[model samples]
Target: MSVTAVNDVNFATQIRKEGATLVEFGASWCPPCKVLLPILDELSEQHGEKLRILKVDCDESPATASQFGVMSMPTVIVFHNGEPVEKLIGLRPKSVYENVLAKYS
Candidate 1:
């Protein structure tokens, strides 16, 4: 499956029960978020079986955004077995993401 979209209602359950998850906190209006989408989508397709990439719209899920202390858009955090393993703030090269996935995937 492609990346999952998360919200406040499903956030906890998803992370706690889903095994492993990578979440991106972003907003539709943010330019960098927009730019990052295609890259993430491509990565998701490239690593479909190895990773579970997810997104949370900060505008729709304020509580989740606050819980993670997401002060910026395009915050990419990788979680394994309900714990965060790595985080990348702002825009980044796709290679960086691929490398991280290779480790935990």
Candidate 2:
């Protein structure tokens, strides 16, 4: 299960119609964002049917970034039923992500 790339085009539908949506706001040039990418991929694979990970390229979609109020790189926002429920900024351990998500899952 690979992380899906979200944009202004599909952001609304994807977040609104999902079981659980984890949106990663990142840029390809950011180092920390790069590090978080694999972790997200692994999580996506592990939680295949239960979770949906969406990657948003901040540089490519400034509107979505601004709408989400993502001022920094590697910002991760988890949504349930079209509303944001959790937000994490910067890099974090895989366990931390897993633990937090376990509550929602």
Assess candidate 2 and give its lDDT.
0.88
> Backbone collision count in every prediction?
0, 0
Local distance difference test values of all predictions, in order: 0.84, 0.88
lDDT of 2 by residue, 1-105 (tens): 789898888877777354678899999999999999999999999998889899999989899999989999899998876678899989899998898788787
* Candidate 1 C-alpha RMSD relative to the actual structure: 1.6
The candidate that achieves the highest TM-score relative to the unseen native structure:
2
Model 2 off-target regions past 4 Å?
Answer: 16-18
Measured on C-alpha atoms, candidate 1 has an lDDT of: 0.84
Give Cα distance to truth, residue 34, candidate 1, Å: 0.8
